[model samples]
Structures are given as C-alpha cells and as structure tokens.
Target: MNTRVVEIRNPATGAVTGTCQGPTPAGSCPYAGRDGVVPCAGRLVGPAEGDPRCWPVWVPPGCRQCRITFNDQAVACLRAAERYRDQWDAGLHRERERVRALAARKDPRFRGMSDRQLQVTALWRWRLSGPAQGLRHAEQKQRDWGRMYLALAEQQRAATPPVVVGGAA
Candidate 1:
C-alpha cells in the first residue's frame, strides 16, 4: 500500500508543525513537510486510550469495527493490579516476620506486656489478612484476563482454517 503523507498543523495559529506518511498517521514525531502537501482540515489527532503521544490519525466510523489495537489503558490496569498484588504480598511477609520476632523475644516483660501492647501486636498479625485478601482478588482478576485472552485466541484460531501442505491421502 502506498503511504500517504499528511501535514500536521497547529490548530490555534494554523502554523504547520510536521508531516507524517502512513495509512493512519498518528503519534508520529512532527517534521517539516518537504513535499509541499497542504494540511487537511479537521483531521483527528489524539492518543488512543493508553498512548502518551497525540497520534495524528482519524478513527473510521464505528470504533467497534476497527481492528484491535494494543490498548494502553488495559496494560496500565494490569500493571496496577500487579503492583497491588506485590504490595500486598510484601505486607503479608512483613507481618509474618514481625509475628515471628515478637514470639522470639526473651524479655519476660515484653512477653507479658500490657493488654494494649498485646492488642497492638495482635493487630499487626491480623492486619496481614486484609492484604492477602486483596492479593487474591487481584490474582483472580489477572486470571480472568488470561481466560479472556485464551478464549479470544481460540476463537481466532477457529475462524481461520489450517492450510494442507500435501495432497489428501
């Protein structure tokens, strides 16, 4: 396919910023047009969901009909979930260590601390449960995405038949 060049201009002042050549010229770095192509008015330019740069491309009518593009939002969500899971796991580990340390203390006074101290110590031991639960929830969501990915892959495979390499036996 021939790559078409499009001129990107500043909307406010109408000054040309750069030129891009592609089917859908979006998110490309701005460069001065050497071919002297005029900029088209009302061309769409913006990052799709998760992209950082403002891609200069137009979305065809009905976004649902467009091919599946790598969504940054979905990736960001997954990363956030992973961070939450990691944070929860760390908290759980720290809580376990604290419990162990408290259990190993030799001082009798420390062992027979006041009710408030005992409650505070027990609170840390119990606090880990919340993070563990949060991690489970995050992991479940990750698994759900994995299942969805697999299902989509299976559907795609089913839609496309394998080509036979040799004559039928």
Candidate 2:
C-alpha cells in the first residue's frame, strides 16, 4: 500500500527531476562520521538542512532510493479514491436514468412484462430478423430467447393475483 517512489534529479542544478525504484546497496560510506561528509558535490547546495524535498548526497545502507514520501502516498490515495467515487456516482446516475426510462415507456408488445423479460424479448426479436450469419444462428438465438421468455412467463404467473370465484347462494 506504500506508494512512495524514488525521484531522480539533475546532478548539476537539481532543478531537473525524474523517478526511479532501484534498491539501495547495503554498504557503509567511507565518509561516515567524518566532518567532510556532505551532499554529493554534483547535488544542489544552500537548501535547508534535513529538508525532505532536497535529495540526499547518499542514501544509508539497506535503504531503498525509490521510496515515495508519506505525504505523497496519501495525496495519491486521495486522488484515486475521488476518481473511484466519481465513477461510482456516474454509474449510479446512468443506472437510475435507465430504470426511469424503462419505467416511463411501456412497449405494447411487452405489456405487463418485467424489465429483464422485455429486454430478452426485444433482443430475441432483433436477432431473429436482424442480419444473422445463418439460419442455424438465428434458430439458436430464437431457442435461447424462447427459454428465457418461458422462464419469465412462469415467474409472472407465479406472482399473479389469484382470481376470485363468485359467492354461493
């Protein structure tokens, strides 16, 4: 879940920036604990000491050079969460519109049919007469459609209101 990545910079001016995920070597620097220890000569100077933005002269042993900062990872996660939220909202809106449209218009051919039943019927009809590659293809589609239609019909019957008989004298 850590989204940190190492950044590469221009050794001359430090103005140029790039990124890399290479692993840092596990060895001590010869200049460790020496007063002469400093940022790489090519690295930029005059920046605040211990500034996270400033690239280090050398990374410590057993460390990764390509790690991203905690702040950077949090920002990235926020952006991604916002994007997913937007997508989910858009999909929900579209689905709502679809259901509304389906409810608003009633196809005479599919009167009393549920949305899925109507869709199956419509698709079957379209495929039955539309540019099918062969008669067998059309037949197969028709059979599938028939099975679906029958299943829907059975469900509808099961859910139908029972008719009442006349009262006896």
Candidate 3:
C-alpha cells in the first residue's frame, strides 16, 4: 500500500499481539499510527465461528483481511532516508545497521543490496516490483487454465452425436 503498516507482535514470543493489547491503559507504543493498529492475526479460532487457521492445535498465525491499517509515516520517513545510508556520517553507523535490519524484515531480498546499490537502482521500486510480478504470473496461469477448459468443452461437444427425434420419417 501507499502507507506503511506495523504488525504489532508479542515481544516475548514474536507472535502477533493484536490491537486489543493497546490503551486506554498505562502501557503502549507511543508511536501508534494515525491510521490505527492492526488486530491480532488470531481472534476467532475456528471455521464454525470464524477462521480455519485457529484450528487443529499448533495454530499458525495467518493474516486476515481485518487488519487495522496503522498509517506508516514513520516507515515512509525511514524508507526515504534508507537508500542514502552509504553517505551518512560515521556517527550513523548504528542507525545504518538498524535501517538495513528493518529493510530485511520487509523482504529478505533487501539483504543483498548495499545502500549505494539501493540508491542507484532504486530498491524501493524493486520492492514494489515483487507483488506485481506475482500478480502477472497469476493472471497468466488463469488465462491458460481458462483456455484449456474451453478446448475441453468444445471437444466434448464435437464427440457427442446429435439427438434426432421423429424428423426423418
């Protein structure tokens, strides 16, 4: 999306903590986005009541459509400055490390790219490219399947003899 979203996770377990963890209480991230927080990936735990991922024990946390889209001005800010890390002062070495780590979390492919490489070739563009590429692949696959189904239907029709009632008497 055009904005950044932080999936709030349990610090101890790394499992998504969900939006319900927040205030009106004494403790919460001071940086809650203007857009708000995403709900925990797990809420209702079954197909009869809600989601299938919550079932069969060993329940894996999967994304649901009901995510709270917290506005990501902070992430956008970091993304703007990240590609220029190679030129940042030596004092920013720790910041550079932090930013690279964050980028990798977004996509593992980012790990191979140096800051200069990111800037020169526009890593953000590449990051955006991945999802579009997947969409293109899906569209191509669907088209192939549709045509195959059509051909099969046509062949079946051709093989069937026409039903003639009392017309030739």
Best by lDDT: 1
lDDT of 1 at 157: 33
Instruction: Estimate the TM-score for candidate 2.
Output: 0.30
Worst 10 residues of 2 by lDDT: 38-47
lDDT of 3 at 112: 74
Model 2, residue 107: distance off in Å is: 6.6
The global Cα lDDT (0 to 1) of model 2 is: 0.39
Q: Please tell me which predicted candidate would have the highest TM-score against the true structure.
A: 1
Q: Give lDDT tens digits, candidate 3, residues 68-151.
A: 211122233344344333333232444445556666687565667777754534433433555544544554554555555445
Q: What TM-score fits each model?
A: 0.38, 0.30, 0.25
Alpha-carbon deviation at 101 in model 3, angstroms: 25
Score candidate 1 by TM-score against the native.
0.38
Measured on C-alpha atoms, candidate 1 has an lDDT of 0.46
Question: Candidate 3, clashing residue pairs?
Answer: 18-40, 38-68
